[model samples]
Target: MTYSKTWQGFYELLDTVYRTGRPFAARALPIRLGDEEADRAIDLLYQPLRDGEGAVTGIFVGGYDVTEQVRSQAALRDSEDRYRTLLDSLDVGFCILEMKFDEADRAIDYRIAEANPAFARQTGADVAGLWVSEFAPDLERHWFDTYGRVALTGEPIHFENQADVFGRWFDVRALRIGEPAQAKVAVFFSDISDRKRMEEALRVLNASLEAQVAERTAERDQIWQASTDLFCVATLDGRLASLNPAWTTLLGWGEGELLGRPFLDFVHPDDVAATTAAAAGLARGEPQPNFENRYRHRDGSYRWLSWNAVPRNGRIYATVRDVTAVRAQAAALAEVEEALRQSQKMEAVGQLTGGVAHDFNNLLTIIRSSVDFLRRPELPEARKRRYLDAVSDTVDRAAKLTGQLLAFARRQALSPAVFDVGEKVRGVADMVDTVTGARVRVVVAVPDHPCFVRADLSQFETALINMAVNARDAMDGEGTLTLTLTCGTAMPPIRGHAGSQNAFAAISLADTGPGVPPDLIGRIFEPFFTTKEVGRGTGLGLSQVFGFAKQSGGDVDVTSSPGRGATFTLYLPEAPAALEADDRSAAAASVSPIGAGESVLVVEDNIEVGRFCTQILQDLGYRTTWATNAEEALERLGPDGAGFDVVFSDVVMPGMGGLALAHELRRRMPTLPVVLASGYSHVLAQDDAHGFELLHKPYSAEQLGHILRRVTRPGRPRRTA
Candidate 1:
C-alpha cells in the first residue's frame, strides 16, 4: 500500500525500526484510505522483517483496525466533557455516594465518590472522596441507610433534608447507578436554603393569620353571647331569624318560641298597629333609634318594650329592653305629683281662711249681741219693729260671713257618721231646687242602690246646697242642674286629698250653664276669690265644699269650660255596711232652767260683754261676779276659789286666754267648775277645750242658766283641789 502524507510519521517510525533491526510500535496512527474524505485509526506493531532474528526490516502492519474503537472513545470523551460542563453550570448539587458496610451487611458510613462544582458550593466544602461521617460527624445514619437501600434495592427516593453541618437545606433525589453490587447511589439535589427560609416565613405568616382569625372570632362570639339586652337578627319580613338568650330571660319565652315567628306576634293587640308601622319603616331602610310598644309575655302579661334597631343586607340588627317597671314608676310619680299639688292648694287656702276668721268673728259677735238686745219686747212698737228689722238684716249678713269663715277654716264641728249619700242627696234635692229657683230644673240622678259614706250629714247637705247655688249662678238661674251620684272603687284624684283606692261615692253636680272661665276655676275654691260681683258673692261656697270634703277624708273636683258647662264632683269615702246613724236630736234639745242659787265668776274681754254676762247670771238666780279678763276672774275666784261655785270665762282675752286661765284655776282649785266660751278661737279649733265645759259665744240668759245648773249640780264629779 502506498503511504500518503498522513502516514509519513508511521513510515518514518518503520524506517527507524528497519535500520535498527528492532520492533516498532505506533499508537492511534492515522491512514488515508484511497482518497476518501474520512481518516482511519490504527494501533500498529512493527518488527524487523528478518528470519529468526530480532532485527526489524519493514514494520509489521498486522495490528487490528482501531478506527471504530477510537471514534467511540472520542465520542464518549466529548459526551463526558459536555456532562461535566453541564454539571458545573447547574444550580443543583450533584453527587455519587458509595456506602461502606461491615461483614454483617450493616452500613455504618457513606463515601462521596463524585461531586459536582455545585455540590462543593452548596456544602461550602470539598466533599468528593470524603466519608459523610468525616465531613459531618453528626450526620444522621439515615443518609447511609438511604444510599445503601437505593444501591441494594435499586429504588429511587426523592426527599428534602437539612444538612446542619453547613446550615443548609437540600432537596435530594437518589437512585442506584451501575450494577447492584456497586453499592453506590447517584444523588441529585438542590440547595434550598433560600426556599427553606421563604417556606418558614410563609408558615409563620399563615400561623399569624390563623391566630388573628381565632381572636376576631372569639371577640365576636363573646359579644353575641354575653350581652344582657335582647340582641336579635331578623329578616326584612318582620320575622325573627335569631335572638340572644335575653329573649328567653326578659320575655319569659324560649328562643325557639321567638325565632322564626313574626315579631308582631308578641306585640299586644293595642300596640300591634304601631309595631307594624314601625316594622314597615324598618323595611323601608329606615332605622328606628327608639320605638316603644307593649309586648305580650309568655305568661299572658304585657310588658313595655323599647327597641333600637338598624336594617341592612335584608336583615335587622336590633337591641330591645323591657321597660315595664319604668312605666309603673312613672305612673306612681304622676300620682305623687298630683297629691302634692292638692296638699299645697289646701295649705294655701287654710292660711288665707285662718288670717281673716279671727277679726270677722269679733265683728259678728258685736252684731249678734246688738241684735239680741233689739229683739226685746219692752221697746215701743214702731221703734221696736224698725230697729228689729234693721238689726235682723245686719245679723243675717254677719251670720253668713261667720259661717263662711268657719267653713273655709275647716273648723266647723262636723258630726261624721255613716249615712246614705243617695238618701242625703234626695233629702237636699228640694232645698237645691228652692235655691236654684223655678227657672232652673234640678235633676237627681242617683243609683237605686244606696251610696253610703262616713261623713257629716249636715255638711254633706250643705255641700250639695253650695254646689247647687254655684250651678244656678253659673247658669244665670235658668239651666238644668244634674245631681249624679255614682259609687265605685276608684275615684278621680282630688286636690288637697290623696286619691282613695277604696270604694267612693261620687256626687257630681253638672250644670248646663255658662261655665266659669278656665283661669278662674282654680281660684273658685279659694276664700274670697270669686268671679261674681263683690257684693253679690262671699266666694266661700266652693271653698266650703272643698274644706268639708277634705276634712271628711274625701275631696272635691271641678270641671269647667268657659261658655259651655261646669261640673262639681264630691268624692267621699264609702262607709262599712253595719253603720248606725248618730242621734243629734237629743243634743239639739233646749237646755232646762234648773240653776239653783249658785255663785258664778264671769270673765269677758269686752266691757259690754262682761256686764251683760254678769247681769244674765244674776237674773238666772245665780250669784255673779264680773271681770274684764281671765286674770281678773281668777283673782275674784281667789286661790281656793272659795266664793265661786262655777267659773265662766271668754276664751279669747287680752292678758290670759280662757283655756290658760282654766288650766291655772284647775291647778289652784280643781274643784271650781270652769266653763270656756268663744265664737272662734284657735284653741277651740284644735279641740284643746276638752277639760272645761265649752260654751259657744252669743249665749242667751237661758243657755247660761242651764249651763250653770249642769256644772253646779250636786254630787257631780269634780276635779280634786
Candidate 2:
C-alpha cells in the first residue's frame, strides 16, 4: 500500500471505503506507476469481503487503465474549440438549415438549426433555432426548395439570388452536411447588393448608348434623303464615291450611273477648268469658296450650279445648288431695263414736240399780227403802241411757256432761301380761297409754332398754287381742300426713291374730290399727259410740283383710291430757325440801285436773242459785250477781263457749256462776278448751279438790269442762285 501526491486522491477513496465498511468506485483516478513512467489514468473500485454471517471483512479492489480513452476525449475537446473559433471569425454568413417535409415528401419549410454571428449581420435578423416561416412569412418558396434539394440529394449548389423579402441579393453556396434523412444543409452566403446595383447601372448605360446611336443614324439619313440641294462625297481626284438622292432629282443622273466616275466628266466643257481648280484647292486642305459653273443635264442642256465644298480626311464633301432660274431672271431684267429707257426717251420726245408745236403756234400768231399791223403807215400812234404792247405781251407769254416746260423737266434755276414754311403756307391758303371759288371750302391746319425750310421761296409758293389748282379741278370746283403743315417728320419712300431720316417738313394738301384713277396716276406727272378734257388742262400743274420738290432736296408723295379723294404730300428738308433769322436780316438790307455805266458781258447763243440782250443792257445805260458761245465768251474776256463788272453767260451750248465757262472764269479770277442763264440744262437740274447767280431765259429788262446792278455794286457781296 502506497500513498503520494499523484495517488493521494486514489488513497482517499480507498481509505473512505475501509473506514466505513462500505464500497465505492472511482473512475479516471490519476496515479503513477513510477516516477519515470508517463502519467496514467485508472478506474478503481472497492468492495468488502465478509463471512456468511455478513460481518465486516478484508477489502477487495478491481479497476482498469483508462489512459487511451482519456487522451482521445482531450483531443476531441481541442478540435471542437478550433471549429468554434473559425465560425465566429468568418465574414461569410454560416448556417445549418433543417428542411421539413410534408406528407407527400415535398419540401414545405425550413428551420434554422445553427447560425454564426455573421449570419445575423447579413440577414438583419438572428434566426438561429427558429423556423424560417415565422420570421419571413412571405419569403419565396424557392428558397426552401433549393436548400431542400441539396439536403435530400446530399448535393452541393452555388448560386446568386435576390431575397426580395429582405431587399438584398446574396451569393450563396449550400451543401448537405448530415445524413440524407436529417434533411439539413450548411449554407454560406454573402450580401452582394452593392455589386448588383453597379452591374444594373452598367447595363442601362449600354442600352442608352445603343438608342442614341440609332437615333443619330436615322436623323442623318432623313436629311440626306429629303435635302433639296445636291450632296455628295468624292475622292481627292474628283471621282464620286457617294451621292444623296437630291442629285438624281436635280440633274436626272442615277447614283449607279454616276458613282465611281469622275464628277468633272458631267461638267460643261467651258466649266471643266474652273471645276478642276476648285476640286484641287479642296484636296489641298483648303475649303472652296462658293463658285458657279455649268453642269450637263440628262436632256443635253446645261444648268448653272453653285458649289460649296469642304475637305475632311482626304475627301471632299460638297453641296451644289441649281441657279439656272436665277441667271435667266437676271438676263430678262436687263432687257426690261433697256427697253424701258428707250420707251421713256420716245415718250418724252413726243410730249415735248407736241406741246411746243401747239403753244408756240399761238404765240407766233400774235407776233405775226403785231408785225403786220405795225407795217401800216397810216396807223395812229396809240394804235401802233397797242399792237407793240400785244407783241411784247406775246413774247412774255412764250417765255413763260418755255419756263413751264423747264420746270416740268426739273431743270429750272432755283433761288433757295430759309423761310418759315407755316407762314408761307398760310399766305398761299388765302390765295387758294379765290382760286378754288366760293363752292369749295378751304381749311388750313397750320401749327402756331414756326416750321422752317431752306428752299426756293417762289418755287414753293408756285408748287402750292399748282397743287391747289389741281385739287380744285379734280373736285370740279365744289369740295373741301385741307392744308396741313407738320414739322420734324421723316420722309418715307416714294416713287421708288429711298427714304431719309433727316428732319423734314411735310405739307399735305388733301382734297374731298374724286381721286385720280389708278391706271392714270403713274402718268399724271408727265408733260401734256392730262386726264381733263383737251381744253381744260395742260397737265403741267402736278409736274411742276414734282419738279419743285426734287430740286429742293425733297420728294412728293400722293395717296389716292377710287372714291376716297386724294392727298398730295410735299416733303422738304427742314432748316434751323437760326438760318431763317440770318436770311431775314440779309433780305432786309437794301439792294443798291442800277449802277451807272456798269459794264456787262452778255453771252447768248442765238443771234437775235443775243442782239436783244445787248440792246436791253445798252438801253439800261450799261456798256455791253456779247458772245455767241461759251468758248467765244472766254476768248472775249481775254483770260482776265479787268474792264468787265460782271460776266453773263448762257448755260447750254456746243463744246464748252456756260457752267464750264463760269467755273473757268471763277478759277482765273475768284473775285469776278458771274451770272448764268439757262432754259433747260441737265447739269443744273441734277445738281445745284455750283453757287452762281442764275437767271432763267426769257428774262425781262428789269430782271436783267436788277441782277447786274446788285452784283456789280461796290460793297455788295456776290449774289448767288
Candidate 3:
C-alpha cells in the first residue's frame, strides 16, 4: 500500500516499538487512503512481532477504519466550545457548586467550583473556586441546605432570595449535575432587582388606590349618617330606597319601616297631593328646591317639612327640614305686631282727648258758678227763673260730659280708699237700675262676707253705672244686668297691668245682651271706640270703666261669645282686712264751717280759676291771697313776703308747677298746710301727690270751705283721707 507523508510519524512509532520489543498503538492516526486530493483519516496499531525466544523481529502493523472516531472527537471539541460560548453569553448568572457535609452528613457549606461572567457581575465579587460562605460570609444556612438537598436527591430546585451583602435580589435555580459521590450543584440565577422594585411599586400603588377608595366610601357613609336634616334616596316611583337616621329621629319611625315604602304614605292627608306633585317634578329631572308640605307625626299631629330634591340615575335624593316651630313663631310675631299697632293708636287718642277734657272742665266750672249766681237772683221773674234753671241744668250736663272725657283719657284724679266691694255693689244697685231703665232688670249679687278693694268709691260706682248703661244699649235697654262681687288669689294679665300674684277682688257686671264681635274684642278697651251707632251711644261708657279699673291698679276684662251675652270683670288688688273698717265710709259727708281767722293762699294758672277760688275762700270767711302760677304762689309765701296760714296751688301750671311749689314749701315750712288742685295734671296721673292735701277742680263753695278749714286747722293729720 502506498502511504502518504502523514504515515511517516506512524512508521517511526512502529520502528521504536520493534527496537524496544514492545507494542505501540495509535488510536486515531491520520493516513492517506487515496491521493492528496481525496485524503481520508485512519487509526493504526503498530506492534513488534517476536519469536518464542523473545527476540525482536519485523514489526507487524494493524490498521483500523477509525475515520468516524477521529471525526467524533473533533465534533465533541466543537460542541464543548459552543457550550462555553453559550454559557458566557447568557445574561443569567450560572455556577457549579460542590456541597460539603459534616460528620452527620448534614450540609455545612458549599464551594463554588465554576462561575460564569454573569455570576461575578451579579454578586459584584470574583467567587470562582471559593466557598459560598467565604464569598458571602453572612449567607444564610438555608441556601447551603437547599443546594445540598438538590445534590443528594438529584432534584432541581428553583427559589428567589435577596443577597443583603451584595444589595441584590436573585431568582436562583439549583440542580444536581455530577455523580453522587462527588456531588456538584449547578445554580442558575438572575439579578432580578429591577423586577422586584417594579413589583413592589405596583403593590404600593394598588394599596394606595384601595385605601383611597376606602376613605371615599367612609366619607360618603359619614355624611349620610351624621346629617341632622332628613336625607333620603328614593326611586322615581316614590319608593324610599335609603333614609338617614334623622328620619327616625324626626318622624318617629324606624329606618327599616320607612325604607322601601312609598314616601307619600307618611305625608299629611292635605299635603299628600303637593308632595306627589313635587316627586313627579323631581322625576322629570326638574330640581325641587324649598318645596314645603306637611307630614304626619307619629303622635297624630302634623309637622311642616321643607324639602330640596334632585333627580339622578333614576333616583331622587332629597333633604327635608322641619319648620313647624318656625311657622308658629312667625304667627306669634304677627299677633304681637298687631297688638303694638293697636297700643300706639290708643296712646295717640288718649293724648288728644285728655287735652280737650282738661280745658273743657275749666269752662264748665265757670258756667256752673255763673248759673248758680243767676239762679239766686232776687229780681227773678217767673220766665227769668225758668231760663236760669235751664242754664243750671245745661251746665250740670256739660260738667258730666267733661268728666266722662277725663275718665276715658285715664287722667281723672282718683281718690282711692279701701272699701268693701260687696257693699259698694249693693249700694249702687239702685243707680245701676236707674241707668239700665225700667225695661232692664238690675240684680246685685254680693257675698255674705265683705270683699274689700283699694279704689275710688265714687269712680267705682260710676264705672259700674257706665258698664250698665253700655249693656243697656247693647241689649236695647231690655236685658238683665247683674253686678256680682267675688274675691280671687290671682288675676290674668291685662293691657296696662301685669298679672297679679296677690289676692284680688272682682266686681263682675254681667249683662244678658248681644255678645261683642271677635274682631272688635281687642279694640273694646280703647278710648272712644264703640260698636253702636252714632247718637245711640256716647262710646265713653266702657272707656270710663277701663280707665277707672286701670287707675285703681286694677284691670277690666270682658268675655262674650257672639249671641251669648257678655260679662265685664273688674280686677282690683284686695285691700288689707284691717283698712276695710277705717275707709269703709266715703269722705266725711257734711262740710265743716269755715275757719274765720285763717289766712289762705290760692294759686291758679287760669285767671278765672284763681278769681273763683279766692272769692270762695273769702266767702268762706278766710283772708285770701291769689297767685296766677306756682312761682307767684312761692313768691307770696316767701320768708320776706306776707305769708298765709295755708298755701293753695293749681297743679297744671306753665312753669314751676304746683307739685314742685308744694314740695319746696313742705321743705321750708314742714308744718304749713299745702293744698294742690287740678282737673287732670300729670302729677295726679302718676299718683305722686303725697304729704299734701289734693282737691279736684270744679269744686263748690261748700267743698272748698270744708277742705280749706281741714287743712288750716292746727294739729291736723299729716296725711289726709
Local distance difference test scores for all models: 0.72, 0.78, 0.72
Which candidate should be chosen as best, given lDDT against the real structure?
2
lDDT of 1: 0.72
Most TM-score-accurate candidate: 2
**Which lDDT value does model 2 have at 26?**
75
Per-residue CA lDDT of model 2 for 147-169, tens digit only, reads 88888887677778887867799
- Model 3 per-residue lDDT tens digits across residues 160-261: 788777888877666565456777776667677875411100000001232243333342344345445576768999999977777778888888888798
TM-score of each: 0.44, 0.58, 0.50
Steric clash pairs (candidate 2): none
- In model 2, the runs with Cα more than 4 Å from the true position are 1-241, 244-302, 306-326, 333-341, 380-386, 577-595, 628-640, 714-721
lDDT of 1 by residue, 594-666 (tens): 5677777788888888787777777778777788877677666666675667888888888789889988888
Please report how far candidate 2 places residue 297 from its true position, in Å: 6.6
Model 1 misplacement above 4 A? 1-380, 411-420, 447-457, 487-489, 495-497, 562-564, 575-608, 625-647, 653-675, 686-694, 698-721
